[model samples]
Target: MVDADQTFVIVGGGLAGAKAAETLRAEGFTGRVILICDERDHPYERPPLSKGYLLGKEERDSVFVHEPAWYTQAEIELHLGQVVVSIDRYAKSVRLGDGTLIEYDKLLLATGAEPRRLDVPGTDLAGVHHLRRLAHAERLRGVLTSLGRDNGHLVIAGAGWIGLEVAAAAREYGAEVTVVEPLPTPLHSVLGPELGQLFADLHREHGVRFHFGRKLTEILGQDGVVLAARTDDGEEHPAHAVLAAIGAAPRTALAEAAGLTIADRAHGAGIAVDASLRTSDPDIHAAGDVASTLHPLLGFPIRVEHWANALNGGPAAARAMLGQEVTYDRVPYFFSDQYDMGMEYSGWAPPGTYDEVVIRGDVGKRQFIAFWLAEGRVLAGMNVNVWDVTEPIQKLIRSRAQVGPEALSDPSVPLESLAG
Candidate 1:
């Protein structure tokens, strides 16, 4: 057992930081574990914010990870509304916003990513928001609720997960939603045009207006409130509010300032971590969106800003920090809830590797599984409303299972039966 005086300081109070502290207690670490977060709100599940919370289907407290009493019982110190400005490596301490020096035996940096800004004009308008923190979601939810009085239009910039989800959520609330994407298809960079087309159709069925191959040139505002937006295609989208869900950049400034090594991800920005989830400084560990951890399937570091990644990554990194030798390398997984569809995707597939996708059911009926294969090997599987295949698909990815198209397309063939 670690001495009660020994401190493990964690930065950022998102899913990652909370999970790490929870895991520490679970693993018999009775020493001091302090979670310092900049956000004053309690740690909550982020997935719900894009779906249920935005649509008023879930209350704010429903998404909370741990109650206040649980943290107290677990002996985890909560430092709410604390911003870590820098780290003093030589002093083995962190400098906070209020000039408090927090010394640590080991530091776990869960300083999650920040929303990427839209470089266009009028981005600072009152009704223009970015979906990253809980405050933003609540503020937008309130704005969406008040839309009954206004023209009730929401212009979402970028067609990424956040944009698509909020667009779907707003449409659910009977608000006019428009999505602007520079790519020919939203999520084209990852899911390809065919799958992306499915999402476009799905949203269109929900009455969402989409502008593909268009960029936001400017956001027009009246009295510092977003009223309209202009696209690169020379079109204007009427809006009561605009959400810039373009993307996110890792919050590595403090870690880098402390002389910690950082690396650029292939598709995003963040400090690079090894397979063990340790940064350049052995004593300092990182996870969540801020730390680009190694993915076994991709054979390189990936920064996945998702609830599952953070929840799982936090514990894995914490165990490694305790010299437990825990490996976080699992088949990459992500889940999304759009409309009534319950979706889960796994595996690493390079672009152009999947020319054919074998579907087990119908897309319109909202019951099916799509398998992305490269040649004869299973590259990835996307379960749409059907979750029965998740277990086998996960095993397949781990073993790099090679199955024929006939087996994949046949619903009668049990996925587990093909397990090697």
Candidate 2:
């Protein structure tokens, strides 16, 4: 029942959109595939922007989802550097910035999120930066190197993953780094106070200064060049460069204009999609950071902005668009690399969701698996400097079986056996 004449339009050129196009072809969809991307560069993964690429460990080509010729060979009409200005759900078409109208039988919105801007004054200064795009990373890489050579100071506004990773990179480059976070500890929301302190300690040991319980109130600069950053506590930090690693907001203007249902702030505040990744309009689907999916297993609507979501969500959405039975309930997963330590966290356990945190292995050595439990049932797990345990950790979460905290903390206990 495949229709060769049918055209599927994908709006967004990030990993999700690119993977969706790849999935369409892999799934034997002979229909016309059109991918519209605002960025001139070919679709690429975003993680390297803050990780390997920023640290100069990865080449520019490594970030791209595919070779430039792959789209041509796959028969995917890739319109790069073209912006989709509007989505006309009624006409089943999208209007580009150049005023080109392209009709579609089904549409996918993979538009990712944009970095949240610092509303404080002097953010427009030359040394103030945000790390959301490849261009930003490219610029930041040189800036960090220059800062390091001159022993210039870097003031980071948040202690989130991006903030910490960039701090690590800056320290590795031999630059002075000071992170300002409003919360009591780094990654306060995700890891909570318990494990959040661990990251704070790790960064501190790497010579990164932390200004906890404070917020960057303003960036002080002269002649449009960042000189220093002022915290809410009235502490002034000399800053040759300032990085706003606060957070990102989903790009949902087109979806909202097209009358698609958007989730509320409490539910991630993104384009609302069912478990199938289908939006309010049956012909339209949303994925990646822009899609707030009502998860079946978690029993809540969640929008994840991690790299893993885009890596998997796009293909899932493509299969759903192909009229295949689909349910996107993959456990939320993310990882971070700082200094000499690398860690992977699986599942969702925001502050109140878990009653206790159990640790296996040694915390002092930074080699351990931390588990969040609620009523003796595993809610989430994080492995620090531990390898080959993500499978069992995910299984434990999926199993939803009650487990003893003592057994969870014991290194002798095999995680696979307890997963049941």
Candidate 3:
């Protein structure tokens, strides 16, 4: 049991950090709970930043995890806009950016990720943006609004979830958008080429242009403001603004500096943690994007950068800190929305891990549940424009049922009834 006088310090102010603080208090940890946040605003949900918040459909108040008043009432000390510079494992304390030191009996590192920037020339120019934080999204929203109504052209670099979602939102704003991807099909690695082609067709139907198998060579700007982009094929595409939504890198500098066991660089360079989310140092635990822990189902160390992972990792880390026996083995899940189509995927598998793709419903109509199977066992499943079926899909994966494609593709056979 933790001593009542102990202090618990949490770094990073994203959902993971906020949820960890909530878990600490909920589990009756009366000790000092200090949350160090680098962001000016209190912890908030990020999904809306790229969607509703950007479109002005959702208010700012709705995005925050908790009101400032809630933290005061809970007696949790929230040091906003403060950066944690270093962790002194020997001293059992952390040094702030301003050189203030704070001791802690336990610490949770939930430092999230930042958007990856394009290394091309003219990225420093104004109107070139990446969407990982609220500020970035807000700036992109303003540009989208101004350029959208004029039917301005918006050039998107990368065709991942964020890029596609932003493309959809830009189109909704009446902007002519073009997505540049270096792959034959977008999301080809994750959803496989077949499903990726389905999405490609979907976007094309909405008049969104795509330039596949092309690389961004440079961003053309005039007077420090973006105007267009050039591809490797020596073709210039006009653009009022450019959004590079490639991916995000985990914020693991503190963990690396603290001498925590960092996984191989190929494995995402995250803080290597055990099944309980405990890092090399027992008192330090890493969650969120910064953690690369053993995945029970995958039998490997996979670090996922999804909302659900952060949401679930927080509570699990807190419980483990209290010396409570626990295993952080929940199946990974994520969702995306674009152009009247919604998708929810459960479970994780490396690209090419599965040999067969089984589908139910109608792909031609853009409504279907597709499962990726390896050796007749369901490894992952995705429901597109299909509702109230994620539970059954998750159950199917967990059961590890050796189900045939015929039964899996049969709409008459319920997923829950499989494995029997």
Whole-structure CA lDDT of model 1: 0.85
lDDT of 2 by residue, 1-420 (tens): 335699999999999999999999999999999999999999999989888999999999999999999999999999999999998888899999999999999999999999999999899899999998889999999999999999999999999999999999999999999999999999998999999999988988989999998889999999998999999988899999999999999999999999999999988999999999999999999999999999998999999999999999999999999999999999999998998899999999989899999999999999999999999999999999999999999999999999999999999989999977
lDDT of 3 by residue, 1-420 (tens): 335589999998989899999998899998999999998999988888877888778987888989889998888889988999999999999999999999999999999888888998988888788898877877888899998778899999998888888988998898999999998898876787868998899889888899999989999988987788999999999988999988888888898888988888667778888889999999999899889988877788888888898899988999998889978988889998887899999987657789888889999988999899999999998999999998888888888889989999999987889965
Residue runs of model 3 more than 4 Å from their true location after superposition: 1-4
Top model number, TM-score: 2
Query: Could you tally the backbone clashes for each prediction?
Result: 0, 0, 0
Best-fitting candidate, measured by lDDT?
2
lDDT of the structure predicted as candidate 2: 0.95
Candidate number with the higher TM-score (2 or 3)? 2
lDDT score at residue 359, model 1, on the 0-100 scale: 82
lDDT of 1 by residue, 1-420 (tens): 347687899998999989999998888887889899898887777888788888888888888899878988887889899899989888889988999998998899998988989999998889899988888888988888777345499999999889999988887777899999988887887688867888998899889999999899999988898789999978899988999999888999998888887876674567778888888888899999898877766677778877778989999988987889767786778888888777898876645867677788788787888888876778788899887677888887676667888988889998886657
The reply for model 1, stretches above 4 Å from the true place, is 148-151, 353-355
| Per-prediction TM-score to the true structure, in the order listed | 0.96, 0.99, 0.98
